[model samples]
Target: MNVFSALRAFRELLPVLRPEWRGMLWSYLIGTASALSLAGLTVLTAWAVGHAVVERTPPGPLWWVLVIGLVLVRAVLTWREMDVSHALAYRVLARLRMALFDAYARSVPGRRREHSGYAATVAMDDIEKLEFFYAHTVAQLGASLTLFLASLVSASVLLPEAGLVVLVGGLVVASSALYRARAARRLGEQEQRERSALSTRIVDALGALREVLAYGLAPRIIAETDAATARAAAIARRHELLSQLVTAIRELVITAVVIGIIAVSSSAAGVLAEGAQARLSPAELPALVALALAGVAAISDATATLTRLHPLVAGAERVATGIGRAPVVSVPERPRPLPTGPLGLRFRDVSFAYEGRRPTLTSWSVELAPGEHVGLVGPSGSGKSTVIALAARLWDPLAGTIELVTPDGTGIPVAELDDAALRDAVALVDQEAVLFHGTVRDNLLRGCAPRSDADLTAVLERVGAAAWIGLDDELGEGGVRLSGGQRARLCLARALVRRPRILLVDEVTASLDPATEQAICDVIAGFPGTVLVASHRAQTLARLDRLVDVTDITGVTGVVPAGRTGGA
Candidate 1:
């Protein structure tokens, strides 16, 4: 990306960072002082050497005092700088992660066709990489430049010839940025793509490791992963080689500048062979060379720092793409209040499609009054789940509005409801419900803030799961070791505890035994509000008050998948 464009991406993260500006201020201040102190040490050492030589004296008490004091100051400043910057970086990372998660939740179920694995990488690793930029790279670069400028000014005061060389060398290094500017940006973009692809493959492989092993597909997956890794490696190698090539040129330029300064200064010292030149002493030569050498070395620092950030610039670009994504479902500026008492839902002529695919739902419509239980059935891909998604407002209809109607005839657009209110009004239980890594109670109350032990137990009983998931029981990741039926029951209990106004269940009993399926169906039937379930089993559909054929509403049709026959 261009510098302007790369910086623009950084701007997207400001909303999450704005609140922590106070901590950033402290970090920057400490870093600046540290950098300046280090720079000052070099100058002071050179000045001391010059005094010692010109005066024909070994040293003085003050010389040791100056060196010791500068070293101590540098140490203290460096420590403080690191301490403050990390404090800010960690805080920013935490906030960024939370914001990314919230964005995903708001855009999923309906908008889930987008790159989920890529987003996961952003929330996990890409955001973490930004710590270098947010914490050290940004502030350290600023401080280093400031110190370089100050050092240049001091050099000019002492020896104008040397100072000009330093100034010109700095400009040359800065101009070299133009050489690889376009290529670097392209490489950065390519690297970002490869990294995201690699991350996606890793996430997908791990998520489906069981199936991969069962089907003996490990070789194919391994080959694919290896290919992605090789591609990423190639991109990284090309990028690094280019950066190193530039750095080499930069070092050459600095060397040339240093040589030029030495020759010019030496000639000047010679001109003192007679009149004014005679006053210039040979004793000052080492000090002048030392100062020039130190100044030249700063060029290496500048070049190295820029090269280090080249990769991150690309990572930041990807993160910006994610953070900049416009959510498929938009929340209203002023959300309407939720319906009072039980909630009645209506979908009027809704239509939607995922990018290039044909319309998944075309001018579809449905209505469910409060306290009614409706089941959706049709062949696969007939948009059964889409209906439930619309009611939950996961995505807005392309052609119509999903509304919540009160008894008094008030129509509240689902989008107009507050997020918390919307969440409280709808609960979704899928066939493969995600159970997080935590205690049973933690997974049960993932986001419900006002949950109590009594409420938890009651919910468990409602789902016929009181026997398996005790408050302190360890369920492990994704509820490992739990029977399929137990897992379903826990998920069901989780949904039941929410007490939502509308419950959307997507084939929750597709793989369950008859007893477990009936038990789950009973729990859902007893729910006191609107319930919309999409299932292939005739038995499950028959349990509802009525069945709505997705084919009739979505203008698409299909035969039910054969696997669901056992449940019915």
Candidate 2:
């Protein structure tokens, strides 16, 4: 990306953190004060040295008091500035992290299986790299510019020629950033991609550890990860090398400016020029040199900060894009309230297609009246899950309206209905309904208000899980401690406990034993709420009030290969 685009990407992150502007402002002020104090100290010390050595006159008692006081004050301000700036950076990072998570939660699963590893890197690693940008860039740059200008004014007041030298040198140092700006940004982007790719592979391998070990693919994954790491390292090395070259050049320019300032100050003192009038005394020569050096050094530091931004540009872009991504599902400007009474689901000519693929549901239409039990039987990938997703409002349909029909026949479009109301009305229990790593009660009551043990016990008993598992029982990651059938029972219980008006089940019993499947089906059969089950099993389909053969409706063969016993 070009300079404007790179900067624009970084700028995008500011709004998410705008609420923390107070903290940022304090950080900036504290940091600026700290920088200015240090610069002032340098000038004061140079003045003392110049007067003492050149004129055999030591600084007065007032100068001693100012120097000693500044020293102590500078120490405290440095600590405070660091503390505030770091705190501000961390706060902003925390907010940014949450924003990224919110974005991912919305857009992911919609993107199918993209690089999960890359996402992780953005969330964790890439965000960490942004600390320098937040803590050091904006405030420090302001402080540097202010100091540079202050020094320039001081130098010019002392001697106009000295001021001119300072100005020219400052401009040269600042302009160095424009040199190879594109190269720095490109290398930074390259480094970011390589690192993210490497993280992706490593995370992928770790996640599929079972498959890797079972298939003896460890070596292959290792080789691939090693290669990715090497490539990333090489890119980083090149990036650093380029940075060093820039730094060297900048230092060379600063050195030249300092030399020029010393030469000019000498002439102003009438030492180098035979007939030149003395514009500055010999006692003030070191002070003039110090002012010029410090002024340009401030700008030099700012330039260095800009140069460092190149490494961060790519990561900033990723983070910005990730956090700035629009939600797949939009919240309505004026959400309509769900009509009171029994709620029925209706999908009228709904159409949706995934990215780079055929339409999953083409002009699809389905309806379920209150308390009606319907089963959708289709081939795998035959849009069964897509229908469930649309009904759940995970993603809006590309075309056509899906609404909830009220008792009075008022159809409230899902798009227009309040999200929380919809979620309360509809609960989905998919095949992979995961139990988080927590106590059973914690997972059961997650995000829920409150419930008594009696109420909890009643819900767990509905799915035949109360007998074995206590409310406080621990469930490992994905509830690995439980058998598939047991996990299914608990998952079903969790959904039922919500008392959702409309329950959407997606092959929840497909992998269960016949007995477990029957028990789970019994819970659904007993539920008074509206039910929609998508299953391939004959027994599972047989229990439903009615069945809709997807192929018959759409004139497309079943996407899932199953012995369809025909629609009920």
Candidate 3:
């Protein structure tokens, strides 16, 4: 990345703050007041000191009052500026997090290519690193520019020579920010990559802790993590060295500007030329120097802020990319409501494929009658899961339509239905029975309407989970504390809590013991609404009313009945 690219990245991200204009305005105003007050204090003290020393005049009560008041005002303004800017930054961060989450929700598992850990890193860590950009960069830069312009005008009015020196020196200091710009951006990007990779490794290790421990790979994992950390630290050290070099150059320029102002002030006061008429009074010399330095320092401060932004450019770009990801499925412009009553599922000549892979379903069609129970049976990797996912609208088929068929045989395309209505009508429980880190009730109530304790207890009882777990019992992260069967039952109860019109299960019983599997199958066997279970397990399929083989259903284009094969 270069300066231009960094600026473009920020340009893409800055629009997320449009809704916060009022807060941004307040932040800018407070920041400007703070910077001006500090400059005013410096100039006022210098003027009083010069007057007393060079003119033999004691300071008046008004001068003392102004100095004291400026100090107090500067302190308050400084604190208030931080409060407002940080508050505004956090609000923007929250919105960015939500925006990223929404993007992931729509775009994820598209081709199943994105790593969970990398996605988490982008959402949490990358977004967090942008706090400095949001909180300190924008309004503070504006405030610094405002102070520089104010001081320049004041110095020019006092003495044109002093103002000219300030302008030249400010430009030099500002230009220092561009020093090693390309190298800084490259190192920053490398650092970001290393950090994200390290986070991903750690997350992957934690998620597969049992396998790692079982294979005795802990030492190797630890060594690899240490190496990654060292690499990241080295990159950080290089960035720091470059920043320090720029700061050193900036400080040297500021020091030289001060010396130049002193010389100009002394010459105007007739100190360097004997018997020359004094154009500037000796008493104003200190104040003139102070004003010049303040003006130049403002420019330096702004440039320093810009220099620090190089390290954050990569993070900004990641966040921007994550937020702007192309959605896997398009939302309907005008969504039609689902029909009122039990709904069946219909796949019409559907053709789908994962990225870089052959088609999973080719011109295939299948349907379940309303209130009928059907089992989808096929060999492993025969697109049973793909069929279930399409019916649930996780991804749309590349060619053809999947619909929710009403009792009267009217088919409403799943893509055309309102998102909420579609979600309400269909529920899916897959092989990986995921339970979040929360109370049993929290996981069950996710995406469900409010349910009373009695209603929840009954659902848990239906799944045979009420015997071992209470509604308020905490399930550790990913239900680590629960047995496999227990987790499966709770997941089933969660799906049941929604009371969806169509229940889609995908090989959820493949790994369970025979007894537990039969217990789960019994619950599905009793569901009254339309049910479609995809499994290779004979016992699980035995509970359904009929079976449809995925391999036999491809190359067909019409509604195939639950028990029969269709023509190619």
**Candidate with better lDDT, 1 vs 3:** 3
Best by lDDT: 3
lDDT of 2: 0.82
Rank by lDDT, highest first.
3, 2, 1
Candidate 3 at 251: error in angstroms? 0.8
lDDT of 3 by residue, 1-568 (tens): 6557778988887777678778878888999998899899899889989999998898899988998998899989988987898888899888889888888888764466778898888888978877656666778888999999998899889889998999999999988978888788788778888999999999999999999999999999999999999999999999999889989999999999999999998999999898998889989999999998988998999998888777678788888998888887789999998889988888889898888888888888888779877888777878999898888888888999999999899999999999998888899998886899999999999998899999999999999888889999999999999888888898999999998999999888988999999999889878888998888897887667677878875522323344334211
Clashing pairs in 1: 1-185, 272-277, 272-278
Give the least accurate 10-residue stretch of model 3, judged by summed lDDT.
559-568
Candidate 2 lDDT tens digits, 1-568: 6557767877888888888878777877887778778877888998999889988888999998999888998999989988888888888778888989988877764545567778888888878878667766778888899889998998898888888999999999998988887888788878877877778878888888889999999988888888888888898898889888988898999899889988888888898988889877888887788888888999999998877777677788888888767677878999998766677878788888887888888787777778777888879989888788888888887898888887566678998988888887888898888899999897777656588888889998888988999998889888988999998888887787777888899999999999998898788877787888888887776667777766564423323224433222
What lDDT does candidate 3 reach at residue 420? 94
Model 1 compared with the native: what TM-score?
A: 0.89
Q: Which portions of model 3 miss their true places by more than 4 Å?
A: 110-112, 553-568
Best by TM-score: 3
Q: Each candidate's lDDT (Cα)?
A: 0.75, 0.82, 0.86
Question: Residues 452-488, candidate 1, lDDT per residue (tens digit)?
Answer: 8998988888888777558788888888869888888
Alpha-carbon runs more than 4 Å astray in model 1: 1-16, 58-65, 109-112, 179-193, 227-231, 234-242, 267-274, 278-295, 553-568
* C-alpha RMSD of each candidate structure in angstroms: 4.4, 3.4, 2.9
Which whole-number lDDT from 0 to 100 does residue 476 have in model 3? 94
TM-score of each: 0.89, 0.92, 0.95
